[model samples]
Target: MRVLLVKLSSLGDVIHTLPALTDAWHAVPDIHFDWVVEEGFAEIPGWHPAVAHAIPAALRRWRRDWRSTRAERHAFRARLRAQRYDRVIDAQGLIKSALVARQAIGPRWGLDRASAREPLAAWTYRHRVRVPREQHAVSRTRALFAAALDYSIPNTVADYGLARERLPVPSTAPGDLLFLHGTTWPSKHWPEAYWCELMALAAADGLRVLLPWGDETEHARAERIAVAGAGHGFVLPRSGLGELAALIASARIVIGVDTGLAHLAAALGTPSVTLYGATRPDRTGTFGEAQIHLSARFPCSPCLTRECGYRGASVVRPACYEALDPARVWAQTRETMSGSREMAHGA
Candidate 1:
């Protein structure tokens, strides 16, 4: 069977969709699985051995320019239509994704709008599988396919096989923990002062700390953490996604906020403790991978709002993360790392 799985954009969402393939492939071992994904995230699907092809949907770059966009998109559409896939699964339930799946020369399938992350995206599917809304996003993807194909969903299987390059871990004993302190969205970030305290505590325990910064603001934030920790912190050179993955793979442990890199760390099977604020771990947390700590103390938690509102509030102000104490996070970090070591030793 030539199966086409459509999931594009947002690193976390793509990571969540990975496990579905394990069961899908098992259900159809002779299947040739090809994923339609954003160019930026295409590397992820390429890491999976079950995937026969990683079809790049350059939607991210498409909106930026017209000439190249039209040329590339036309070519991509032609190639996709030529495949005549046996089954096409729209894992990403968006209007654009549905349209893309329909463009494929195959019988189209997707989640019903009520079950879709984006409900409106469902109308475009030729067939919609109604799944439980409460299911975790990863499970939702797996269940959607299972429901459509009449195959049982398999137990969780986390496998991402990245090709090894010349990138190698340094020979020096790892004394420092990697702290990913920046996020694309401001609402998801933990308080800067809290990071300062965490870095200080980690360094005090004789662990060197390095913070990787992407932009100037993140660089400034790293500088602030370094100054607060009295030079125990330093920023790493700007890195591409693959390099960042390699770096996270080498770290003894990763301490981070709830963001893409943090999710990447968990998906890579590295020891990590991610801080959650407005988001619920159940919905999109590290799956079958690493330890996760969530702050559910706030009454308004799992608000699902990019911004929190206190009774009569409608803006994106998040107070849930602010209530998380540094000491509590530190304790969780230690426990997670200890558990990771035990798991490693088969104890």
Candidate 2:
């Protein structure tokens, strides 16, 4: 069967949709699958071996320029309509995503009101499947596929694209650790001082640290971490999605504070430890992996506030992640890495 999965925008959301690929592939082992994602995260769906195509759409960028943007959208819509897929699923329950799915070739499907992240997006789907609201993002994604294909889904980690590649990493490496400290939201970031301290602890334990960057903001943070570590860390050049897979595939462990890279590492089956602050990990935490971490002690946690609510709050501080000491994260990193080594040797 030929199917098209439309999920565009936000790196984390795109990563979360990956498990649905597994469901589709499993239901129809010879399924021909294609994906439509935003330009920023176009490399993701390609990581899945089952995906026959990864079509890049730049709705966000196209919206920037009035004339050229309209032309681009028209062109893309024409191309998408030409494919005439047998089935098109809108995993991303957003108006834009729904419209994109509507442009595809066949019967449209998506989650009903309760399951959709955005209720209005449900209007775009001809076949609506009401998913369990309580399920994790991964489960919801899989459920969407299950409902679309009328196939039962088991509680299994069906990661078909995450076959680990043997990228040559250093022996003295900190046991394959990847640190992701970048996000679109300022409130989501753990303090730079905390990251520096975490790096020191990793270096002390003889573990190698890897940093991946796609833009200037993350690149700057990576540079600061390297500088703070006194040249103890490694700087990966700006790379495409394939390079990202190569980098994460080599890691024995992944650590970060609620970023797409952290989630990607988890999706790739690398043991991941993610730190949560303003947003609840329950809504969007690392999944399909055994190793995960979260911190929700702050009274104002999961506020869903973009900027720290210090402006109007009486406390006037970044309460959510302010108290998360680097020492604790470092200790956890050490333990996780040690655990990976022990399991490897059966010690």
Question: What is the C-alpha lDDT profile of model 1 across 197-219, one tens digit per residue?
Answer: 99888878767787888899998
TM-score for every candidate vs. truth?
0.89, 0.90
In the range 198-257, model 2's lDDT, one tens digit per residue, is 888777766678776768988988887876555568867766665666677677878887
Return the clash pairs for model 2, or none.
84-105, 173-208, 174-207, 174-208
Clashing pairs counted in every model: 2, 4
Candidate 1 similarity to native, TM-score = 0.89
The per-model lDDT (C-alpha) reads 0.77, 0.76
Best by lDDT: 1
Q: Model 1: clashing residue pairs?
A: 176-208, 307-316
Distance from true location, Cα of 75 in model 2, Å:
2.5
